[model samples]
Target: MKKYLTQFKPFLVFISTFFAAYIIVTLLYKFYLNTFETNDVDGITNVVGKNVEQLMDLFNCDIKIHKSIANSWLEVWYNKKYLVRIVEGCNAVSVIILFVAFVLAFSGKLKTTLLYIVFGILFIYILNVVRIALLVVLLFYFPQYNHFLHGTFFPLIIYGAVFILWIIWVNKFSKYAK
Candidate 1:
């Protein structure tokens, strides 16, 4: 038993740190969400929606995003067509949380970990905004593949990026890196 425990000590530590960071951050996010009114979108989602709107606008695309009067989401209009709603889940904060947790688990030096987390969060946020914009354009042109685009393709992109980041951290930056 002691031998087994010794062999798996690193794995156990990683799992514990990952879960601890994930749960704590998630709970903090939940508390933040709870502060919003029932029919109001949270600030982060609102910012994400605005960023998407601005991004599309930069390309001269006819894009407009407005807070839905009857719900806690932002309505995205592309080329004057009601295409989708930007919900809290669309903000990518959850993905950032997961990324942070993994980075924490495989942490290197304090300065490196903090810097990586900041940059990683920014990268994910920017990628998410661009993803939403691209998704809007794609959905507008390919309405038939909404499920595949939203449920599978875009998720694969974001999560794949995160996975790549994790691999980079583990191999090149984490304390365990050889």
Candidate 2:
């Protein structure tokens, strides 16, 4: 029994840490939503929507983003035409939570781990915002490929980036690497 338990210790530790972090972060996020006055748009969703609008404007795309009439989403318009809806799910906080949990489960030195988590979250957030912005433009130009782009290609890009980042951390910075 002792030998069996010892053999599974590392797996247990990783699963425990990942679940602990994920639950804590998800609970905190839920608390934030329950407590805060999100008005029509939640903070993270609003920020992502605004970032997408700003990026589009930078490219002279003439974008407009405002609260959707359907639900808690931001309706994005390009050249005054409805393009896409930016929902709370598009904000990428959940992705960041997953990324953080994985990193914590595979942690290295304390300071390095902390720094990597912060930067990794930032990178994912920025990439998601950009991804949303570009997706809008792509859908506008190529509405024929809507299902393929939104359902398959874009998800692959975001999750693929996360996977690459995980590979880098596991190989370069994780204690498991040593």
Candidate 3:
């Protein structure tokens, strides 16, 4: 037991520290938001969806905001259909990648590290918002195949984008499998 602990303590410490920082930061952000009556979209997403909503409105498109049943969160509606969910908030797929990058960097795990996780998170966030906006529009423009677009095509494209970003980061910065 002692030998194992001695061998793995550093790895454990690094993982724990990285996870602690990520969780604390995320929770504190959530706590701060909880103290206010402001909408989640504005507070969280920096109003990207809100801005898009206005653009859609200007086109005489049918998009609106609907209050969520659970979180009181606002959702984007188009032609009375739920267009964007969870308000202006983006999804977390890219965020997890960011976390992995950050923890590895902090722990000195990855090799050839260059661009840190902050940039990765920001890049992914912007891409996610853009993805949502595009998906919403595609739903309206190509109504007949909305399911295929949403369930398969767009996901492949957006996730593919994130994958490419990760690959670039790994090849350029992180020296994995080496």
Candidate 4:
């Protein structure tokens, strides 16, 4: 038993650190969310919606984002067509949290780790805004593919980017890297 424990010590450490970070960040986010009224959208989601609108506008696309009176989400409109809802999940905070957890688990030097995390979060946030704007435009053109685009394709794009980031961190920057 002692031999087995010794052999797996690194793995155990990684798991514990990852979960600790993930839980703490998630709980903090939940506490932030809880501060908002039931009918009001959280600040992060509101910022994401506004970023999406601005992104689309830069391309001369007709885009408008407004809070939904019927729910806590923001309504995204493209060319006066109701396209999609920008919900909390769409803000990519969860993805950022996941990324942070993994990075911490495989952490390098303090300065490197903190810098990587900051840049990684910024990249994910910007990617999410662009994703939403592109999704709105695509949905306007191909409403029939809404489920695939929203449920599968967009998720794949975001998660795939995060996965790639994780790989880069583990291979290039992590303390465990060879």
Candidate 5:
């Protein structure tokens, strides 16, 4: 039993901690958002819905949020009257990935670990905000390209950024042997 556990300890830790942190952060964020006074839009089907009206008033833009449902997943869209959907739980991915990286910091490399985790968290948040901002802009300017932008480009860019950070950590920092 001890041998079996030790053999898979790293993988176990990685997966378990990653998911645990993901769930905790996601729930906390949901709770926070629900408790906050910020506007929460619901059941939008297209760009002309009440949510878009609110967005327009808030941003002073004639642009709107376009809405779509693909594979049963809702997408919030923005348009020069286009559709947008509210994505409630995507931040979990970044938080889990960050947690995994933080765990790796203690695995074999302790040097610069704390600093890396701090910057990693900051970078994740900033990147997500940028991703949201870009999506809104793209939805406004290029409605026809919404599928590709939402389905492919943004995911590639954001995941690619995270991947690069992970690679830099493992190669340059993690295996540095102190």
Candidate 6:
């Protein structure tokens, strides 16, 4: 039993850290939701929606972001036509939480781990915002591929990026690398 436990220690640590971080982040998000009066979308979702709106505007696209009829999403209109909805899940907080948990489970030096987590979360956040914006544009022009783009390609992009970052961290920065 001791020998088996020793061999699986890393895996154990990883699973525990992942679950702990996920639960904590989820609880915090719930607390934030309770504390605020976000009618349609939560603050983070609203921010993502506004950022997507601004990005679309930069392309000279007629973009409008408004409160959705469904109380948990933000309605996005392209050229005055409803194109997409930005929901809380689209904000990428959950993704960031997963990323951070994985990184913490494979942590390196204190300073390096902290800085890397910060940068990783920021990168994921920014990438998600861009992903949402581009998704809207693609959906607008290629409505036929909406399901594939949303359900498959776009998620792959973000998760693929996270996977790459994880590989880089484990190989270069993680204490386990040595």
lDDT per residue, candidate 1, 30-146, as tens digits? 999999999999999999999998888899999999999999999999999999999999999999999999999999999999999999999999999999999999999999999
Q: What is candidate 2's CA lDDT for residue 111?
A: 98
- Rank by lDDT, highest first: 1, 4, 2, 6, 3, 5
The runs of at least 3 residues in candidate 3 whose Cα sits more than 4 Å from the true structure, single-residue gaps closed, are: 38-42, 51-71, 75-115, 141-171, 174-178
Q: Can you tell me which runs of candidate 6 are displaced by over 4 Å?
A: none
**Residue 82 error for model 4, in Å?**
0.8
- Writing each residue's lDDT as its tens digit, candidate 4 over 1-178 gives 9999999999999999999999999999999999999999999999988888888888999888999988999998789988789889889999999999999999999999999999999999999998998888888999999999999999999999999999999999999889
- List CA RMSD, all candidates: 0.7, 1.5, 5.2, 0.7, 7.2, 1.6
lDDT of 3 by residue, 10-89 (tens): 67765776677667767766676677665434355445556556666777878775556566466778787775564433
lDDT of 5 by residue, 1-178 (tens): 9999999886787677656765676676566556633344332122124433464456665543333433322454343443555444444344445555444533444557667776776676566655665677777778799889988998888778777777777667764334
**Candidate 1's C-alpha lDDT?**
0.97
Clash numbers, per candidate: 0, 0, 2, 0, 15, 0
What is each predicted model's overall lDDT from 0 to 1? Answer: 0.97, 0.89, 0.62, 0.94, 0.57, 0.88
Candidate 5 residue-wise lDDT at 88: 44
Worst 10 residues of 3 by lDDT: 105-114
Candidate 4 achieves a global lDDT of 0.94
Question: Each model's TM-score?
Answer: 0.98, 0.94, 0.59, 0.98, 0.57, 0.92
Top-scoring candidate (lDDT): 1
Give lDDT: candidate 6, residue 106. Answer: 88
Better candidate number, 4 or 6, judged by TM-score = 4
Q: Per-residue alpha-carbon lDDT of model 6 for 27-51, expressed as tens digits?
A: 9878887876656467888888888
